[model samples]
Target: MIAIGWVKVSVCFILSSLLVACTPVTPPHTEYDWKLPKGFPSPLVPEDNPMTTAKVVLGKTLFFDTDLSFNQSTSCASCHQPKFSFSEPKKTAVGSTGQKHRRNSQSLVNVAYNSNLTWAHSGLNTIEQQILIPMFSEDPIELGITGHENEVLLRFEKQHYAQLFKDAFEDSQASYDKIVKALASYVRSLTSFASPFDEYAYQNKDGAMTDAAKRGMELFFSEKFECFHCHGGFNFTQSSQHENQRLDLRPFHNTGLYNVDNMGAYPLSDQGLIEVTLQNTDMGKFRAPTLRNVEVSAPYMHDGSLATLDDVIEFYAAGGRGQGINNPLKSPFLTGFELQLAQKQDLIEFLQSLTDHQFLNSNLNYPPVSH
Candidate 1:
């Protein structure tokens, strides 16, 4: 009887060991180091797609990979170059199929702090949603990958990407949803806060900004210039938010760039927020982008109408073009102000001081090598 009981116990133990061996063990989740700049608040991250080092690494690879395009000719990096603060030098971005985009590609610097993703769309609240437009939209065909989803997936299944996807996501399927999430993670990590302006303003570093730039900084935030009304805050934009922000601000202004019929009418093709809201009052209203890297992001404005920072400053000083017709829809802050030639040069220097050379050449922002 003792021998029989021992045999039964041994059999049960063996069965339990087999069951435990067959069950898959989930790997531990990786915690990402945000490396947020001093005086900058944390960027709000999505709950579903938490930031992880693995995801960021995978996203960077996908961002520079041409395979995401239908013809395998272009990638997100083609339009948003790192040297220019992730903004293209062209007036407007040219798509993968050589289609010209009507709107200029906005800079992605500190994009994680933006409440709304695009120049006019308040609905595009997240990078995950905004990325879909450039990748598959047929109206302009940026990546032209709408019908080639399967082909793209197959391309991603190549040895290099397959391993990356598996390591990042724990599943190597290379699905579209995973790609979007990873790309968004990489973009959100492109933060710039080591500029001369930041060093002086936030870090208490003396002589970080030149005397000319110091004077310009005062002018930029002064009530007389009204520059702060639109491009204010640490990120230098009114339409900005960080994790500590209690309210999300989506301020849009009609800077009187155009009044086609003297009726606050913008160009028929691009009517700014009116395209989404269908409100006449909303016509020509566009979101103010961050002026952090404005020095390098030339061909300024939503449509790249202003070719240089000088042109931009002049446009504001003159209270914007066609202001007589579009004044009603323009922001109250657009009342013109005078600046001496010296002051103008100082202001330009101030803007240039906002450029962070470290960020422009950061190894983390660059494309990853294939292993």
Candidate 2:
């Protein structure tokens, strides 16, 4: 009886051990190894579309797929070219079906950090919201998919893309919501961290930037130019809204790109923030994009008015249009400032230092292939 009781106790102990071992443990998520520069805050990843290698890969394929559009001619890459800091050099982007969009294609560099997107529309805060406009807007006809939703889906359903949609969503189907989420995930993952400025400033490395760049950095932060006031911070954007951002969200700025009618207005058609709000105070206001890759992301400005970094410096130095006249909304900060020839050159050099060649040529190209 003693031996039998001992055997029962041993069996119970073995069964308890097996139960503990078989239980599934939620292992730490080590998927994305984000390596941001020092002083750079973590990017705001959305809750619904969590970062995963699989999702990013899927998103890249979707981003470059011309089939996403109604006519099967244009993809997301049409406007946001990878070579030009993911921004087209066009004054206004031409759509898939030959329609021209009003605004210039905004840069994708560090856009995951933007609080507000687009020249107008203060409320379109998330990348997901910003994406739907191009995909479905009819007046402009970006993707030209206003009434061809079924046709678009049908094309994807014919091939492996249907399966790809399932993999990205972890469901057996792909909806517009899932498509947008996947594309946004890929956009957020296009973070640039290896710029020369990042190396010299954050990594504390010597001579990572040229002497001209060092001089330009001085001019950028100097009291004369005061470039840092608006184009400051780790992301080099005024539209930052993350927790550790040093300053509050100062998304809009009137850079004096237009005063077409001399009524303190931007071009009537391209009226910046006022288009959405219909408020005078919001006139000519647009979100400030990150200057991280500004050197390549030209022609500059919300309308692509300024063609080059040199032109940009010239615009700011001249203090915008109607410099002599005082516009009420012109941020008291951007009042006409004088910069010398060498100083301007140095500033341009500094802007160039922000270009990360590695990020620009990153091999994570469009269309995922098998491992």
Candidate topping lDDT: 1
Question: Per-residue lDDT for 70-95 in model 1, tens only?
Answer: 99889898888888888989898899
TM-score, per-candidate, Cα-based: 0.90, 0.86
Q: How many angstroms is residue 115 displaced in model 1 relative to the true structure, after the best TM-score fit?
A: 0.6
lDDT (CA) per prediction: 0.84, 0.77
Clashing pairs in 1: none
Clash totals for all candidate models? 0, 0
The TM-score of candidate 2 is 0.86
Q: Where does candidate 2 have its weakest 10-residue lDDT segment? A: 21-30
lDDT of 2 by residue, 123-154 (tens): 88899998998899887888877789988867
